[model samples]
Target: MVNIGSLVGAGGPNRGQASYATSKVAIASITTVMAMELADHDIRCNVIHPGAIDTPILAAFADESEDESSERTIDGVGLQIDT
Candidate 1:
């Protein structure tokens, strides 16, 4: 099984880093190339992207105060990564 969509947003800290984006994009590109190369062998490739599932980063945002917790998210935890 393949996870092409998984490639989506693998590029975190989206600050226009060529290498970072290039690396993540590689996940998708490689999947495509592999899929094509193996197609003739009767193989198939697919991708899944579980966007925003419960992760450690998001867990850090949890708090006793529901209101405050609501204001926080994984990416914005700590020093407010997002504006």
Candidate 2:
């Protein structure tokens, strides 16, 4: 199983979520084993986690300007389009 989730890199530079990171890590490990075990049953288990979308919470951090805030939020807007 491949998880795109990231508790480590998602909580910004200030917040250090150790518990959240540990949980995600445990979840990832469980997912990996489950996927391997369930593969014989024709079950394709996978997970997708999209980080830092253009949401209101993210907007608060980016209060300078839409263009300015969007740079850090969505990998820089001019270089990429935020989905």
Candidate 3:
């Protein structure tokens, strides 16, 4: 099983996103429990925590144009993951 979470879940609470972060945290926790419970059945469970990407969701929280916001967000941070 695959679950989608966010960097927010791991980073803890943000200024105005308590609910969103909590939901992501739930997904991660569920994934972990599922992994352990399903291991005996040979089922693998995983959760992905992706950083802020260029999307309309990001635009919703931006103070500038969507394109500019996305560019700034993507260019300003370096989030690397090893797969």
Give the number of the best model, judged by lDDT: 3
| Per-candidate local distance difference test | 0.52, 0.55, 0.71
Lowest lDDT 10-residue stretch of candidate 2? 7-16
Regions more than 4 Å wrong, model 2: 1-4, 7-15, 61-83
Q: Indicate the residue-level lDDT of 70 in model 3.
A: 48
Candidate number with the higher TM-score (2 or 3): 3
Tens digit of per-residue lDDT, candidate 3, span 1-83? 88989877765655557799889999989999999999999999999887776566555555343466444544445622221
How does residue 62 of candidate 3 score in lDDT? 59
Could you arrange the candidates by TM-score from highest to lowest?
3, 2, 1
lDDT of 2 by residue, 1-83 (tens): 46665533334332334676766666666777888899999886665544556567555545544564345544543224433
Can you rank all candidates by lDDT, best first? 3, 2, 1
TM-scores for every candidate against the unseen true structure: 0.48, 0.50, 0.70
- Tally clashes: model 2: 0
Runs with alpha carbons beyond 4 Å of true place in candidate 1: 4-13, 16-22, 59-83
Model 3: C-alpha RMSD to truth? 6.9
Give the distance in Å from residue 69's predicted Cα in candidate 1 to where it truly belongs. Answer: 19
Report the lDDT tens digits of candidate 1 across residue range 1-83.
57644323353433334675576567767777888999999898755544544555545544322564345433343343332
Decoy 2 TM-score against native:
0.50
